[model samples]
Target: MYDIKALYEATSVDDACRLLKEHPGSQVIAGGSDVLVQIREGKRAGKELVSIYMLDELRGICLDAEDNIRIGSLTSFSHITKNPIIQKYINVLGEAVDQIGGPQIRNIGTIGGNTCNGVTSADSASTLFAWDAQVEIAGEGYRRVVPINEFYIKAGTVALEEGEIQTAIIIPKKAYEGYKGHYIKYAMREAMDIATTGCSVNVKLSADKKTFEDVRIAYGVAGPIPMRVPTAENFIRGKEVNDENMEAFAEKVLEDINPRDSWRASKAFRCHIGVVMAKRACEKAVKQAGGDVDDRTEL
Candidate 1:
């Protein structure tokens, strides 16, 4: 059981920030999906919870005047899966969040909690990394935005400050413009199982749609944080979207990922699956980008 604690329901973003500033030991809760489990298992220390579930300001999905898609931190996985804006702009993200958990978990689990939880197995992390997403943080008197790639410091840790709360996630227009992407998760079971390894690939094709103008590849459970394979991406960029080049790209992934042995899988097994998932995700992304790889030569 969780220890006794005081519960404060925050009515707005400002109220949540103020409560966090006032109570240094307090923890913020939106969906209580991750924090509650941690508290009951004695993994999280704080007993005071500042609930932001009632703060409607931190919920929704919309495009700002700047053309960046801004998703409020409290936006639930279920909402994300159904948001037309998300499906139209970055459907791969929708695909990633849709596989998070069972119906109940997805209905109440906030994207902020999943990102902030900072686990390598977080299904949303790799996709956000691939999309080059940015996180908007709010505190008592200041606000800042940072690239999602820089958000995670290590496993179960993030760059969030003492009293700052993530307000929204912003996907810059450049990240998703003319891009088609795909996400794939490998696990022992289809649902309710943590990812053994997951991969996401976003490819922006050339005008002719036969070459990869730009590519971003990210993997989950491949390291302490969501793994973005720059070496692999660099190898694939500007290359013809064919089976041979894709195989080379997948092999290059070994130069970046640093998986570890754990109860869920061995390091070697994780690395193997990471490479396999990368190739599969890239193929799917190519298909989504309106390219057919079946006609290409096998390497």
Candidate 2:
């Protein structure tokens, strides 16, 4: 049996915040995709739970006044992939979350839980970073926002306070405007296995479609936290979009990533894959942006 001291169902966002404040050691549970599994494995045994699964206020995707994409924290991966707003604006996010697991897990795994868990290998992590997403948090009497890059402190750690809950993930209009992106992941088993390495690349091409106006690239499992490769991004900006420059950009990305040795992959192997994935992702993104890239390039 699963160990639990108590369970409280929150009726709304305010109720969820109040519950967290009232129960000192309580943790919010949505979808139970990750929390329940951890509890069964004894990692979170005897934990007090604040169930937010029924809070309709915390589930949907939409655009705010500024045209920023706001995704409710409790929105599940399956919902993300099917959401028209997601498809029309940030399809890279949908594509990234789609790779989380099989149909069942996608049905229950939420974007909030995926990001809040603070794992470097979370499928959503790299794309969020590439998009320069922001985390909106709510607590007893205060609300604040943090950039996705700053939200992740390190492996298995995030900047969330003890009583705060994430409300929405915001992708600023400036971050994704005039850009298209792609995500690439390498895992032992394609379907359900955790990613050994993941890369996300986004590009904004010049009007003539001959040069990179700007570029953003990020990686998961490349270090202790999901990180952007500023060195590579800088190199690609204003450069001609051709195979020679693309290959150079890919090599420059290796200068920033710091993958480690693990059972899933070696530091060397992850580093190698990082370069390959970066190039492939960039190419796909460039093509999406109408840049001149080979149509037959193997992804």
Indicate which candidate wins on TM-score: 2
The number of the candidate with the highest lDDT is 2
- lDDT by residue for model 1 (155-237), tens: 88898888789999999999999999989888889899899888999999998878999999999999899979999999999
Model 2: per-residue Cα lDDT over 1-299, one tens digit each: 79999999988777888888898989889989889999999999999999989988889999899999999998999999999988988899999999998999999989999999999999999999999999999887788999999999978989988778999999999998899999998999978989999999999998999999999999999999999999999998999989988899999988899999998889998988888888899889989988878834443
Query: Which portions of model 2 show Cα errors greater than 4 Å?
Result: 295-299
Give candidate 1's TM-score. Answer: 0.96
Instruction: Give stretches of model 1 more than 4 Å off.
Output: 295-299
TM-score of 2: 0.97
Error of 2 at 171 (Å): 0.6
Query: RMSDs, each prediction?
Result: 2.0, 1.1
RMSD of 2: 1.1
Q: Which residue pairs of candidate 2 clash?
A: none
